[model samples]
Target: MGVEGGLKCVKILLFLFNFIFWLCGLALIIVGILVQVSLHNTFMINDAAASGVPIVIIAVGVVIFFIAFFGCCGAWKENYCMITMFAILLSLIIIVEIGAAIAGYFFRNKLSAIVHDSLTEMITNYKNTTAEFRDSVDNLQKRLKCCGMNSSADWKGFASDGNTVPDSCCLNVSSNCGKGAMTDPTKIHQEGCRNALETLLKNNILWVIVAALVIASLQVMGIVFACMLMRGIRSGYEVM
Candidate 1:
């Protein structure tokens, strides 16, 4: 009788566990689906390009949720059919997680290396261009000093010359020149770089969506397994 009671307790615990697992699975699935939809409609691939790791993590969570749900259901039902099904599902989830983890780890490093390389190249190009511009500006400053400020007599020639003048000199030469000459070239480059980086990162949205879907599937399977397990356990108890 004691042994029977112990078994009954175990069965009850198993049923509860299975139910909990099912709920967890369902929640995960819903979350995953929402994430996927958001990515599809709102996020671009570049948004994910900067951090593929998070997407992979979400995917793994989904798979695990499903596995837990199925396992719970199998245990609760005491149905060999469910057990076998759950085992297969769990095994697949485990395998996929392992593969994704490995791939994600390597992919992250590769992306980092690529971004670093691209940044280095961009910086180098920017520096070279900036240096050239600085040299031109310096030369123009020297020319301005040598030529002296243009009066009305020299205004036409000064305006017609293709020489690039500094803002200070431009103001001295013409009020209109100074008004528009204050544009910062460096700021322009910085803005362009920022936009490019953002676009690049948005490229990983598809992968993230895929991961969310997998998690949702897992959650549903978990819930089904849990209910089956509970029914089986109750039946067993009644028979005993």
Candidate 2:
């Protein structure tokens, strides 16, 4: 194809890619918002340390949203300046994504232990804590269909005479399920919160890795096409 025709094709391709990238950015923003909202509903808004994850997600989403806009405008206007900025931003995002994936992989096993310890600590102080705090753990167990951190046995230390587990941990939800679980193993959920939560984290991390790979692939394409279009524009103009 001629230089002009090639440049046109590159511009079209980059524009389409950027459009999709922009959508992904929007999705990220929505996810981040939802996470924060959920945290608020769970009454964890005051926990500054735990709030960092959602805040970071929101920040990344905003950054990506701008970068995608830059890519689109650069392609449309054939502007080298915007193209360079877009490429630079994309490279930074790719680096961050790769680093996060690597960190997640390396810490995969440790994450479960951390979660286990956290849950255990929460359970230990369940009665002494606020209603919101207790409710959060109950909701988590109910959502995961799990019992204590490791097993129903984990609750033995915390359980007073009749209540071996929380009502949320019961196989069949009921007011007296906690007492039932203490007497009959069948009354309680067999799975533990730690394992269930670990599996969930693993799955989510895998999806993140896959998504990063996909986005990185697209960013690499955008970089290459941007460079190609720059060359074509320069060549065509030089001949004029």
Candidate 3:
């Protein structure tokens, strides 16, 4: 009787774990979509590889959503086959997540160079870019209190005067404050935009890493519960 009661407890816990897991999967899907949109629309980061991270997260979430559903069904019905399949699928999901985490880590390390190059390209084509993009550039400078990609000197081609920078780089942002003030640290922000932008991207990547780790840990517990219930059912025990 004690053994039967223990199996019943495991069955209940497994069902409850899977229900929570389903909700976690749904949350990941929503978060992944939001992050992807923000990276493209808000930050204007058009890196193909950077954009692919969120899509992978979405795919994993979708698989997890269905897998958790199967797990719940298996636990409730005390079906050994379904439980076995759940364990297998959940293990695969964990493997995929580990791969993603590794890719994300390497991507984070290279993010600085990526942002530096992209911002340099934007700065070189400042006059040629669309008005909206120019506005984004100006806003980014003002918000980050930065000048150009690496320094105010990067705008030498854009600013006909070698000493001039955009008013967006001004400390007070008054009209003409940036005129002939590229080297005036008191009047303009002399630092580059690259580091600030790179930091922003790295922070976002940190969030993804943390979320993946938390979800992976929870899935591990769910797997243990699933295996325990599977054992009970296979041993001719009624976990229900």
Candidate 4:
């Protein structure tokens, strides 16, 4: 009787853990969408690697969501096969998640490396792109007080003139102050935008990495409860 009662509690705990996993999946989806919007729409950073971050988050969330639902159903039905499958699937997910987290950790610094390329693409195609995109790049330069991805010289040939930069790169807010003034230290900012953009990416991704590790750690408890319940069911005991 005591063993049955303990198994019942384990079953209940597994159910609750699955529910938590469901909620966590939803949260991750929301976070991923918001980050996606912020990085792509707001910041206009369309870098391949940078844009992929949110996509992977959403994918992981979807996987977790489905697996959580499966686990719930398996627990509710007290099916040993279903429960074992859930455990196996969840173990695979945990491995994938741990790998992702470790990759994120290593890639945190490498993320900044692409900033130069992304910014250069934007600046090079500034006029060819839509007005909104132009405004976004201009806003970034102005807000960061930066001229180009690497240096003010990046704006060479940006205009019909031999050397020029956008007015946003000027220390003083004015029209056409950047024309032929790329090398004028007093006229415009010489620093690159890499530092600013890199900082933003790193800070945001750091939180995501931390949250994933925490959730992964908590999932271990659910796995334990699942295994315990599976044992009770497999022994022909009345786990229900």
Give me the candidate number with maximum TM-score: 3
Candidate 2 lands at a TM-score of 0.84
Candidate that beats the other on lDDT, 3 or 4, i.e. the better one: 3
> Per-residue CA lDDT of candidate 1, range 114-226, in tens?
44454333333422456554443323323332111221121122333433223333324433443323233321110222233323333443344454455445545544544
lDDT of 4 by residue, 1-240 (tens): 889999988988899999999988787777777767767775687666676666777778788899999999889889888899999988887776776677677767777666767787888898798999988888888878888888888888688886888888999969889988999999999998888878877777776677577778878888998999999998878865
Q: How big is the positional error of residue 191 in model 3, measured in Å on the Cα after superposition?
A: 1.3
Tens digits of per-residue lDDT for model 2, 101-208: 565465555655556567767778878988888898888788888887777766776555745777888878889678736546678886777777767655654554
Alpha-carbon shift of residue 79 in model 1 (angstroms): 2.0
The lowest-lDDT stretch of 10 consecutive residues in candidate 3 is 37-46
- Order the candidates by TM-score, highest first — what do you get? 3, 2, 4, 1
Q: Taking the tens digit of each residue's C-alpha lDDT, what string does model 3 give over 188-222?
A: 89899888988887877777766677889999999
Q: Which of the numbered candidates is closest to the native, going by highest lDDT?
A: 3
How many backbone overlaps does candidate 1 show?
20
Which portions of model 4 show Cα errors greater than 4 Å? 142-146, 150-153, 160-164, 167-191
lDDT of 2 at 78: 81
The per-residue C-alpha lDDT of model 1 at residue 129 equals 54
Clashes of each: 20, 0, 0, 0
Regions of candidate 2 where Cα sits further than 4 Å from its true position: 30-58, 157-159, 238-240
Root-mean-square deviation (CA) per prediction: 14.6, 3.5, 2.4, 3.1
lDDT of each: 0.43, 0.70, 0.85, 0.82
Lowest-sum lDDT 10-residue window in model 4: 46-55
